[model samples]
Target chain A: MCAELIFYSVVPSEEPGERAEIETFLLRNGLSYDEGIEIFVVGREGRKLVACGGLEQNIVKCVATDPLYRGEHLSLTIVDKVIHLAYERGHSHLFLYTRPNNIAFFAGCGFYPIVEVPGLVTLLENSPIGIRRYCDGLSKSRQPGARIGAAVLNANPFTRGHRYLIEKAAESCDWLHVFVVAEDASLFPYCDRFQLMKSGIEGIARVTLHPGSQYMISRATFSCYFFKEKNVAGDCFTAVDLLVFRQWIAPALGITHRFVGTEPFCRTTGKYNEDMKYWLQADLSAAKPVTVVEIPRIESHDRAISASEVRRLLGTNDFDRIAELVPQTTYDLLSSKYRMKAVGSHTSATA
Target chain B: MKIIKDAMAGTLESSDVLVKVSPSDGPLEVVVKSEVERQFGEQIRRVVADTLARLTINEGVVIVEDKGALDCTIRARLQAAVLRGGAVEGLDWSILQ
Candidate 1:
């Protein structure tokens, strides 16, 4: 017997009842509902929710179909509707996180596997040649050297500590490729942060600056919601991210060493550094392991200089303090942009 | 006609095809994924080429995901996608012949 299905788009923030129903449905299917999901497309056979799919930004997550309606193609319908919704919202590219066993199912939906963290989760993208195209682009900037090194940095405002790390890394290797995190989730916008890094490293001879892509430290690849254990989430996130770097990205650029700064603050970043060693250097069987080099963070006023310190000073309009933390280029830009706001607020306070 | 923006048409339902077109700096590139590719892969490519030729779409990346779609379904979906991708000028209906 064929079962007729109906689909409905539910925004969890707006539809509380439907959100609860979807949460229960996902749990019943052995999938946890990610709180970060922006929207969900649920398929119902009359009053019973039989299938569901979600979109968290450009990543599709928590897709499940009832065992009773396995061959009904309800999963495809839910995914199709979710894709349409994402496209309408200006998301041309999409990613999916699924278990290894379900790779064939999602592949049938046009998603090609990008990377897999064995027995944990697998990352897939809608475009079959997405990573290939990205690697091809990276190949254009490939440099030939035996001790080629790489570093990925957020560089929110290009602090002095960041310059110290890059300079130290560049001095050790024949060539150093520095990638500024492309996601604009920080206080400083991506373009401005990239410009600050470029200006700060103007005369660094052997270092090349490149923009990061979705394959690198991006929201789509760094999500920790797929793991059931909260403790392992951080490790899985680091493994997935560094695996993409070690597999597709490092080989494309001929990088043999990965450099990072000693994290004196932020426990998450510190753990990520520890996991980076295991994922990139310790795993001997996966791919050619890349050496990990950790440089001590440069200190200012007896404390480790950090971008968070600069941002905090920027909040209080303490230009003098911020000046000591960041490079001259970043300090100048911050003063020029925030000085005007500081004056405006001062005038209003007096009035 | 040129693809000025990214556009998509059709659905992933059974016996249907989903066509996605996006602007590209390179030459015309077409990628087709079908369940029956071993049996009718060349036929599907020919239909896509013929449809793009009719629409005068000589550039952009065209991706088609097929699930046992007929030849005519592929053609119609490609035309709709090309049009939606900003190939509106000089769209002579006679090309349908």
Candidate 2:
């Protein structure tokens, strides 16, 4: 039961009007309602619903809360009840689809990503005509300071380029949240990857790390909107990715200006820049377009240093070559028992 | 306290919950020791059942040590612990026939 200021009740009804709203919401989400199943939650004050997840047969679908009353863990309370009801009714498994952005919130409540259909995500991200918002931040009324976020996947090794990009984003924004992508497909585990980024950016005041666990970059990227190569060739992937970055990912993170490197030699990096330039020129009138900064590629004997280059050198067991590409500290990490072969190998090894 | 020790030994020992089946008519006892000391047996049980049902868990006993957990907090934490405890580890639903 919720306190007086908090609401605690579920209204079960077959009324046509109420059913219509629920049905409409479900239809919009491409889900259907079963006859025996019911929808319920304990609502809070200010028309804030404590939880409004649906129970179809045994599956628990769509756990949601009022944006205003988040962080209080009210949805968890209601979900607990729903889960209990499901078990008592002898249901097999609870399943629900949360926007990839909110995956961690559900993960914190013990839901794991069972299956991922990249197609469903592409459909969601590509159509930005009427899609107002894809995620609810900490607040409904956007704070001026809340307008900034850093979309980062520690992919583990934090390269100088990554450090520079994050540093630049922090300098430009009031608050920069560095999200570490949280899928297990990668070689470096989430914890190590998160630690690498956190420590790599350690003294930066505005920078904070969030686990990309279920909802962050991996989901968005796997959906092809982040990479945007579904319709286009490999050459145009960067452009499509940039469009999705601007339209879908940027808004959710409350970011207006994305800071990217101006390294034209790096294929993906260059693609991101090119796409960003196009998006800024074509679409960004209301918001500031992505700010592309040319991070002077670290040079060792006139050769430009990069993560891929470092990984290639390390693959050959060439410590000297790797040392030249990365910082002394990074060399120590790479030479250690934990020499990374994954995303952050370049950064972590060099850091 | 039929504390189902070692039931979760191999898989869940490294994780959270061990092996939770369905709650039988055996009073389904749950003992929660919290420093805050809020008497939440009835509602806690409800959350346990609800979360288990939602997760499609059939039966099990759950004993939680509360560190200032509310109703929802208790449920989420319990669900996490149970899932982590290896009850569903490596059980891929897509392959489930």
Candidate 3:
């Protein structure tokens, strides 16, 4: 009755040949395919894979359409299929990320733009109220100004480097927002990390610390990725995670500068910071709302301080050395005989 | 055009509507659940009734779960639901217009 396109849902990893075909398509189109998410494929009876899309939690990603099927609106169909599946699974809130040119297409498909990191990625949600709610909650206590600085920190255990970075940003801005990554995917649970950070910044009144929501989650901090391979496509999570900051988070809070500590130890984190710097400075001819500021690593001896360093020292029973790495509050918590080994660190490792 | 079976159209996405239709022995019945009920309740009913009349379906129950959709969207969804539920033959495309 309709076009001859046959739509099929396939297990991303179970079918080797199909998986390889999807990878080939993504690789050819300058996209990366992340396994473990639900994949939907469309093609004719000839077994020619023409388009692919996937659903991860409530967000849609990894969409690609073959050049031969350019006018068939395959991306839209795959998105609709995924969205319908999410709805069938009882998920009412849906979101997706696409390049700037496809934003209008998804918008026409009942999704509205929530944030845009122009020329990179655009985040859209199925409902307008979802983003409007975040904006409302953000503006309730945020002071309006161009000098307000923002920092998103996982602070696995809150270290001296974290304090130093916060101090630098706080010194420059009248208001500083510290969003502690709240995903319970690390050596410390989100509750423990939040508590440690709260005690760590007890005296810094202007530097208000907030809990990072799902949108700012790093793959290292999301438990779902603890089993999945990381960075299958190097910059997958970078574009999606930061889109929230660039579009909705920073703007509603009137944050003009985003501060990140330079990385000298972990390559993953270092790459994330580098990409964050580029995203903050990208399309500068348009003068985006927030500019990224990279502060040199807070060092101890000859090495830069990091949460991974502290975690590595935890298993060695060297409390003294670990003490040197973190702030007093983090040290107190780490030394209380309550400790756990951290999983491997992944940067921009968000889904 | 009477509904002979069950059918659904549209979705729960915002600015959209999920319409379900079922054959009934009673007169035309349409119920609406909308996010903007206070603002669009009457309008939604009016548009639904007009759409049912246009489609020539005089005996069926239509359930509309709206997420702030406009009149045109409601009409479109109702049309799809009616066509899918029954109306397999003697369909007049001009009347729907």
Candidate 4:
């Protein structure tokens, strides 16, 4: 049977029960509330809210989804509903108080911050409009102690440069959980991107692919957060994937190490690297904190090759340069779909 | 790796390379022999001239034995050779002052 998705506004009779559930869920999820607010739940089947979110008209604090049902972009859906409702009800601006990690997810859904109060994350759970039920169903769906090594790759379609990084990390780990960015928010769709990474690294054993649904829905680390003006210079906002991995995935599934490419290509990545280093050193007391391995950038024509440069050249229809910069298969795949767009077309907006 | 051993030790054959620099003419060049020119002669000349044009050479001549160097490598070796030759005292001081 097709999964039926439903959306509804909360009535006065359900306030006390929903508020209690919200408090319990917030406490269980380590959230807090500071002001009276409103709450809503969106679910696929009756009496089961797959996602929950609400806003405080006075303070603009809202929490959308629990740790479960995270990768489905359910949080974005919930956030979208709340933003629309808030606007329709005569509020020109809406604010969401979120954990620093989930900040990107909210930003992707078009919410911005006016101020950041450290130690205010708990305020979200304690607020009047938070989730009430503290169900462990989401936590139970994930297998504990499942060692997953995650790589937040921009795999501009994998090249030898990318393969080298993956191979290095795979050698040391049992299951390499390669997270593919699924947001169609990229130049290539998630399917094509996954295929390229898989085909490029076909020989590697014990590697599995997970959809970086969190990343696709994230706006904080990319253009979205910047557009929203929620970022701070030294604050170094974390990606939703990294935040989810730390909060929900790492503790729930047991991620031992995180693989990342060297910061030769991106400033966004440089900031991510710094934030991850700080977290690994600080709060990871259960399992050993996450370790980062900088994948070596390959050299060609005695110059270091990068995805950005390749994309730039591709915009000029320079397949020959791409072949030299990337692997043969990557060159072929990129050229077939992207080559036409090269001749005077702009680079992918996501890039 | 081809060997370069011939009767004229300093003179550049069609295959031999003479690398030098002078401040007045930046990385200037004059091939002693032109018979053995290869496929990308014009391109190679342009590459060399274009690369040298960026330098502040007053006067100098450079000769090269390009078996098959891409534009990038040729430029690298040319730049290296000019720097090396620039260090020599009184050999050809006209261009690299």
TM-score of each: 0.93, 0.43, 0.65, 0.47
List, residue by residue over A1-351, the lDDT tens digit for candidate 1.
646778878999999999999999888888888988999988998899998988988999888888777764877888888888888878878999887888888877888899888887889998878898789888888888899999999887789999999999999999999998887777677898899999999888898899978988888777776555565566677788889999998898899999998887777678878888998987543678999999999898999998876766776788888888888899889888755553321100000
User: What is the model-wide C-alpha lDDT for candidate 4?
Assistant: 0.51
Deviating ranges (above 4 Å) for candidate 4: A1-148, A215-217, A220-233, A239-241, A284-288, A343-351, B1-97
Index of the highest-DockQ prediction: 1
> Which candidate, 1 or 2, would have the higher lDDT against the true structure?
1
Q: What is candidate 4's lDDT per residue for A1-351, written digit by digit as tens?
A: 746767665532368676666556655554553234554444434555555565545124435455666663566566545554554454422344455566544434433332232432311211111111111222333433445576766665566777877787778776676766654545666787778887887888776665554222233222222122234324424433344455445544456788776665467666667666665445633435776665666678876666667767777778777887777778778867777765543233222
DockQ of all models, two decimals each: 0.75, 0.02, 0.05, 0.00
Top-TM-score structure, candidate number: 1
lDDT on C-alpha atoms for all candidate structures = 0.84, 0.48, 0.71, 0.51
Candidate 3 stretches with Cα past 4 Å from truth are A1-8, A17-32, A36-52, A64-77, A87-93, A117-121, A144-146, A183-185, A217-247, A271-278, A281-292, A332-351, B1-97
iRMSD per prediction, in order: 0.8, 14.3, 7.6, 35.5
Q: B1-97, model 1: which lDDT tens digit per residue?
A: 8998988889889899999898987788889999899999999999999989987788888899998899999988888888888658666888765
Error of 4 at B82 (Å): 79
| Residue-wise C-alpha lDDT for candidate 2, range A1-351, written one tens digit per residue | 645444332434655554555555444544444343465544444443334555654346545554555563566655555655554455423444444565555544435443232332222211111123224332242336744755444434556556666777788788776666665544446676566677677777776666553233333343332232243344333333344455545565566555554554555555555655675446433444644434455556776655556666666778777766655556677788455443332332111
Ordering by TM-score: 1, 3, 4, 2
